[model samples]
Target chain A: MIWRLAFATMLVLAAADKRSGYQDASPETRAMQDDDASNPGFLWVQQGETLWAERTGNAGRSCADCHASIRGVAARYPVFDARLGRPITLAQRIQQCRVERQGAGPLAPDSDALLGLTAYVGLQSRGMPIQVSIDGPARPFYEAGKALFETRQGQFNLSCAQCHDGLAGQRLAGSVIPQGHPNGYPEYRLEWQGMGSLERRIRNCMIGVRAEPFAADSPELADLELYLGWRANGLDVETPAVRP
Target chain B: MMRRRFLVLTGSGLIVPLAPMHPARATPVQVAALIAELVGDATLRDERVKLDLPVMVENGNSVGMTVSVDAALGDVRSIDVFAEGNPLPHVLRVRFGPRAGAPRIATRIRLATSQTVTAVAKLADGSCWRDRVDLLVTLAACID
Candidate 1:
């Protein structure tokens, strides 16, 4: 019993140690992510650049037509959309633009075009601190996301906090557990051999714990994303990050 | 009884080394044969080729990697990368055009476990340069 108490105290102290995903990455991975020329995720970012300039749908307008520049735009995403009357992620906003503004068909989740555009937009905000607001109207969703982050589920009876928050920096099945931060969505994953969104990654975690994942664009995922954004409050975004 | 137990322990020790160290996977000899088949009888030197990979990978599914050869090593023809521990060792093969200025390629690859990743470069002068880095993959990829 005394040993159990000491282990619990150790976990609590470990949670206080703040480290970014980059710090947890191997040296080679960090080098690859740090350089644009050597980073594979840039391939998707390049594709996104092309799509940003090309005219699409009946609107004959591109993403560049209105936004002009995407600099620092992604850092403020998963924001409360006044028009939608709810919090929406960057991926949802991209879909919204396609359906409502562009007149183009909605791109499927995890599709190349969607990932490319998201990576490109996210790349623009590289190194900017995440600044998501969970105040006023966004407060309730934030609360729900916090509840989900702490709630236990799955066959393993594990919560996100169990590993990411409590056991972060420790080895699990040989890999170090990192604090579950969403600063690098639309990031390139070596395992996937492609770029993926934060939602896809979250679903992957759910599956890892033997839990049924929420569908793409589910409120649960969005709220969880919002909570993660809040968790990573001041961490600089590293979009298109190359992860193992 | 003590003598009988001692004899049994000695016999077991003798049998252990003969047993396969890694079962259910290709052996190092097999992986070397595959590399030989790819590179042929070319003289593989250790210079010029550079392989960059994480020393420790948290997830085997998406480990970042970069392989490059010194441009000073004359005209380069192609580069082949291999992950000896993966289910399929051959990760990628990149060929450069005649006008290709620098022979540099960057990408991500999946690893089955902790193992050495090798890169072999074929140059225009009919020579092959090789380099390898051993890395730890915490999580296995290609598994559901």
Candidate 2:
């Protein structure tokens, strides 16, 4: 009972401290992230730029043909699509475009090509604040994500809020925990040694907590991502961010 | 007291030369030997190269790092990186051409434990410049 009460107090304290992951990074990491020439994440961005103009599928139309400049497009992801009657992540939207508009086959969830395009599109929104709506059609999914964030389902009996919200900045097994935000992704993680989507990072966290992670591109993960977007509303998009 | 001082001085001199024979827990001597092997017979001057890494890292699995050499070094032939504590000490080796721009490279690398990371630059002049930083890695990477 005492442990539960202490955790509750930590949660309240964490909610009051709204800090971005960037604030927790060391000076050298910050320098690598701020400079384009020194940031390796730009390598994937370059690949994405090439894929943006390549024509594919039966329609023989490239992404550029539909959206001339994708600048600021990623900032509004996890948006409510009236046609789909639900919320969808940027990855889901890309798949939708491929299958419906471009008449191309769906790229694998963790494919290099998919990551390239996602990184490319997300780069356009770099430095822009995320603005996801939780009202109107996006309401139900947003609430579900919030529930998931608060519920403790893992073997460790830890919720996302328990660590990200309550225990952020505290050392866990020798590493500092930052406020879990989804501002920068398709991020370049040093552990993965490559660019990965937000969903992939989420899966890592799930595994860390001994929880059964949702499969890539699962609606649950997308919804959880939407909640993270809302949670990190004002944080600037740092797509292709370098993370340890 | 004068005779004792002489004996102490002689004793210290002997220990200094024999220190390399018995490697300490975290000695730079091993790291230096590794760098010597990479740039055989070349004089490694401790100048110009800058290795940027965090002093304290929470997760050793994916540490962001950058290596930049002074453009004044004229022309750099190659840049090699090593993490002494990793199973494979060699991390990355990047070669540059004559027209290669600035000698700056950045990437993420894994650290098996707390150890010194070394960066060596072989210049066009056949001279080698090196820099090393001792980092405190909390949770090691590549352990799975």
lDDT of candidate 2 over B60-129, digit per residue (tens)? 6667788998855357888999887776778899876556567888787777678889999988888889
Q: What TM-score, computed on C-alpha atoms, does each candidate reach?
A: 0.75, 0.76
- Report the lDDT tens digits of candidate 1 across residue range A50-127: 998888988988888988787888998889887777889999999999888989999989898999999999989999
Name the docking class for model 1. incorrect
Task: Please list the residue runs of candidate 2 whose C-alpha ends up more than 4 Å from where it truly belongs after superposition.
Answer: A1-16, B1-53, B58-83, B90-110, B117-132, B140-144
Docking class of 2: incorrect
**Which pairs clash (backbone N, Cα, C closer than 3 Å) in model 2?**
none
What's the residue-level lDDT of A119 in candidate 1? 91
Compare the candidates by TM-score and give the number of the best one.
2
Using DockQ, give the best candidate's number.
1
Q: Where's the lowest-lDDT run of ten residues in candidate 2 chain A?
A: A8-17
Predicted candidate 1, C-alpha RMSD? 9.4
